[model samples]
Target: MSYAGALWLAVQEDLYTGICNGTRENGDINRPKIIREESKGCLECFDDYFLSQCFHLSRPCLTFLLDFIKTRLKKNVFNPVSDSTSTESIILATLFFYAHGFLPSKITAKLGLNHTFAGEAVNTTSKILSELSSSFITFPASYNDRMGVAQGFKNISGIPNVVGVLGCFHVKVTPPPSELSLFLNTLGYPSVTVQMVSDVDGNLLSVEQCYPGGTREQYVWERSTICQEFVSFRHGQTWVIGGRGLPPGRHVLTPVERSQLKTSAARRFNITHSRVMTYNQHVFGCLKARFQCLNDLGTVQADALESVACIIKACCVLHNISKKFSVPLPREPVLEPVHPTQDVKGKEGEKSFYYMEETREDMIETCFGQIRDEEEKEANTEGWL
Candidate 1:
């Protein structure tokens, strides 16, 4: 039978049973004599069923739940509990009334109690439930530890790459700044620096939040140091650090070479009008433009921008590794042209695309130059030279 049919039959059976059990006059069960109108006792019957199912005070789970309620009450965490009238029956009655969205008068009439008692019970129970919900339903620390870094890189996708592709293309809503601040505050640091890491699939691998009470540069330095340490300990793969320059060979382009590639990519991707000026800007803009172009050209959405970000991040990790090992990079891989084609399923065929060797080289050079310029300015100001 249909669910509606079954529900109707059940309702009929309940009504029949209620009629067989005649109303009592003195025990708050009889229809009020003053009304002299036919009343169905629907509220009372609903209250009885709901209370019977939900309020089993003798059950272990109920006992545990009540214990939590009592503890919060003793802590004076709830305003309702602070105003006295803290009985188990009142708590249960309050829970029932609020759970069903009943007014105090309605609840009192249904449960055979005074309106004042019902009101007090509801107020106290609501406060307790509120506190419980707030304190109990929280994301675990491990979830933050795992997801924090991945979210940062996801944001980086909006920053363009040398190929005019959106490197971190995956749309991810990060935790609000206030929430991040609260999380940092809980770390018991005057100031914290966070280094985020992601995998080839744009999955967040780890987040290292460090205490570095200093200037912005100092914080960045400390976080980089922490990132280096984490990479060394976790991956042990030498090709995982930043700022060491791209893999060496004719195939790989240096910063200057990558700048040319960016200009070419911008033109090819119809983004020449955007006119990305700086190397950093070019790198950021190219990736963003490329993704849009790819989407337009393929007539399909490519969800691999974040994956590209991960690949770049992983290469940065290798640069860090090179610094740690004091070793030069290996030869660059041969570049292969990836052709766009529509498969039988009307989807873009899978193809291999290479990062322009010069693009990464330029990024490292730009980073180093900025660092050196800052150091030089600091030295000249201090007259140490």
Candidate 2:
């Protein structure tokens, strides 16, 4: 190579490098900067629909949740080592992973996190949310609370003293590790059962999840915390209405036999009872509708039965929080489940009226809060002036 050519080449190389690096002042070194957040491509599901679909909430609701979490929960990383991933990013990414049912592998690129980190985010977020469930999902433990729930149900259905409605549904998912056989429903699909107790407005009062697909709704409800403490009858005559499968018990009641009972009162009872019970379907429909991840029917896979249950409990907590914040659920009413056989014949329990009595309206009005347990009686007597 000629000396002149070598000089020219060196000059050109320096100029090219200078142009690429821009000007460096003082001790600063000009180099290509790493883009941490925005450098990773954004997803189309990052807009309004993303917020609603991923978080099952709007901006305001997300803001509320974020604030609550940040305030109450410790700011901790999914892993002990500090990465560029922010706490906010971890939370948002975990929510997306859950809502979309994305595997940690798929969640990595979207969140600018590594595969293991994404997996960590999912675990930590669900654990934190489940721990916070008590603050959000609660049953009526006090008399005032019971009275309010009872009144709310009564107003909606005109079935006085109605406390809440019970229902259950199957959430399809990839089979869990150990109990793959137990997760299979009669329909020959793998699923897990989620039992819910909802008030008039589709607000979840109690959520019992993690049971196998074959688990009966009645069995789940019977084993739930709410059932043991439920004062079925508040106003002597008004009682907690159960799905057809749940036979009448001390703390619970189901409608009369429809085929055997043929009377105006029976029809009226069925109609009114159905009105309140319909929300049970509405709650599940709205939940699955809002959060598509919960409705996987088969696409989204659950890591384990426990993990899925944790997510469900978190969802129930969030659902109650949304209701408390007056977040409107799905607008249209979900139709009641159809059945050709006996009660609870379908996956969704559709409550149809059977029988109660010829007339109980006047009796209900006079007996508002007449029935009382020993504890309540003592408290009532103590407060009596």
Candidate 3:
């Protein structure tokens, strides 16, 4: 309420009370009214320190995102100055909404927006940002780029030919419409299963939103364009590494197929591959760490899975941009293994199981077998000496 309206309401309350008390007749009930001063609230709004802790970005970083929006909007729906909701404010509202996981009402109160305007700003900003997700989060384009990421994975435990790491995380939602059983996950919560691929640097390369948190990561992969392109391109000797949630395939490799590996060579390869895959853990560690909206982790905050998923996609872009600026990672505590950012198993997983068995053995022989041979030669040389 405005200052004047609140004053009038208080005065009316006093008069009504006087009449009810019978302290004054109708003539005396109406008199000049006194209004107590309104207390000051929200002393600080969107401060730099607060933005860093809240929105996970400094003022400069926020401004950069805003500027990107400005340029993109110049040719479209945005009227930076004339629009009732300034582009800058919309971006701030979106960040504030997700950063703190606050509702539109609280956003209105804290951000000082008019009632109901916060939600609009959030929706508008989210749409704008999501549309540009591809502009912000990009996958490897050239062969060199693929090799670079592969080399990064190779650095971890000397694992090679790893173009990327695959993973999934659930974005919680209000109990989805009861009709949609697919939206409910194993945890008995409504969510959207988000599948993502990150380079060894923990930068998100590709992200696809899938429904029903219970949907397996491998199923999502089989249906994803990234997987299709990967399989079709067959970039020589390059493949992404994933958890057992996905079948060992030509497009994606899992640790040296434990069930089939009967030799020491395969065992050595599996040991190293397992260690390198933990880098996926760190990537997710960094992701949910940077974007709190995705994790129910510290606090039980949620929204519509679709909206949350879109917000997450937008944040993913910012996550990439923030990396370029060297924004400090969040100080979130070490996450337990139960963190939602992990894997999924598909019903069709069985069909794809032996899909790449030959490819797997060949890769083992061509990639990891050499390592075993070198080790054996060195051990024999040492014994001879």
Assess every candidate by TM-score.
0.25, 0.67, 0.74
lDDT against the true structure, per candidate, is: 0.32, 0.59, 0.64
> Which candidate tops lDDT?
3
Candidate 2 lDDT, tens digit per residue, 224-308? 7666555343234346677676655544556656774455455556666666777787788777655556766342333356777
Identify the superior model by lDDT, candidate 1 or candidate 3.
Answer: 3
CA RMSD for every model? 24.3, 15.0, 11.5
Clashing pairs in 3: none
Residue 183, candidate 3: C-alpha displacement in angstroms: 3.7
Off by over 4 Å in 3: 1-48, 72-85, 103-107, 177-181, 184-190, 234-237, 297-305, 333-355, 377-385
Q: After superposition, how far is residue 79 of candidate 2 from its true place, in Å?
A: 5.3
- For residues 23-53, what per-residue lDDT tens digits would candidate 3 score against the true structure? 4444642342222323321212223444565
TM-score, model 1 to reference: 0.25
Backbone steric clashes in candidate 1, count: 28
Better of 1 and 2 by TM-score: 2
| Highest TM-score scorer | 3
Q: Poorest 10 consecutive residues of model 1 by lDDT?
A: 163-172
